[model samples]
Target: MKKTLLISHNREKLLNALVYFSKSTRFCGKTKLFKLLYFLDFIHFRETGRSITGLNYYAWDKGPVPQDLFHELKQPDTDLKETIALLEQSEDEDYRLCRVIAKKPFDPKYFSRREKKIMEELSFVFKDALAKDMVEITHLSGTPWDKTMKEKGPGKRIDYSLAVDGSKGSLSLEEIKERMSEIKEVTEIFGDQ
Candidate 1:
């Protein structure tokens, strides 16, 4: 599928987010990391009409997943090469678990105030939650992932607009359309990077 997001996936900011979550929370595994980014992007989009990461999430069995980033992290020589590393830790080892390690310092300059605030909140709230805990949260009924899985089937792209009108959404239908139009205009002008 084509990367239709107008704003390119900001790798620098993503790396920083990873670092921030790694330092601020204990459950920074591949699964939990994806959920955090999902909330960050979807919540931000629900409020502002744009996603922070410029990523399209898919309805994977675990929940909404940024599949591109997922694949890259599972292999070597991706964008995050030196910026971060995933350290395997036994789940039962309470004292020695750290799934992700930041090789670079966190960069706050790449994030906006709202974005930073949301990340901080997510880190704090999910600090002790297990990866499966996040999975359950994202899989709750009426969520974009849940809705998509039921309506569009698995592997389908979860639309950002759903965050605006799904069960947790607060915006009206017309407002959502307007914001989506504006976003489309900006992306059309900028095109895909």
Candidate 2:
């Protein structure tokens, strides 16, 4: 069956918050972490109309660097180029650590060993979220596109796909609504299932 996915800014906020908390020293318990990750995967399932793999890829590919980090770097006085260079010099596992330290006003050494350990654990949260996204997308691929022809009619096919573009980071509700309305207009013109 053909389906229409509705994206929501609230859901995106929740996911972003989850990522933030996962990396935070205050909330990195194993049980709570898994629960938050799964909840985010469920949101991805609903918003994109894709299965869990979509959430996995979304988290894996786009989840690491929070949107706020970029915003902070964009400030007029911020030394973005130097900070990026420092991040690049760090090992893969330490990239987020470098980023967190760079964004905050405190010294990097101020983060205790325990806090650093929490950050490492939180990295897995990111990985799991990405894995869920991938699984959902892979499931969708199994649904043959051509089958729509025989099942729904000759012209019936997927008109648009709900793909996540993380390059822009999370969007506001107004932005999402505007895009949804635009898509609704197109669907009306083309006829809907």
Q: In lDDT terms, which candidate is top?
A: 1
List the global CA lDDT of all models: 0.81, 0.35
lDDT of 1 by residue, 1-193 (tens): 2223242447567778888887788767878888999999998888777788777899999999998887777664444767788888885656444388888888798899989999989988999998888999999998999999999999999998888764454666677779879878877997634
Off by over 4 Å in 2: 1-22, 25-86, 92-193
Each candidate's clash count: 0, 16
lDDT tens readout by residue for model 2, 1-193: 1112632333333333334544453323322333344344333333433322122212222222222333443452223332222222233563322222223232334233543343455455444443335334423532222223334533332222223333344344455556657756865896432
Which pairs, if any, clash in model 1?
none
Alpha carbon deviation, residue 48, candidate 1 (Å): 0.3
> Each candidate's TM vs. the true structure?
0.84, 0.22
Q: Residue 49 in candidate 1 has what lDDT? A: 77
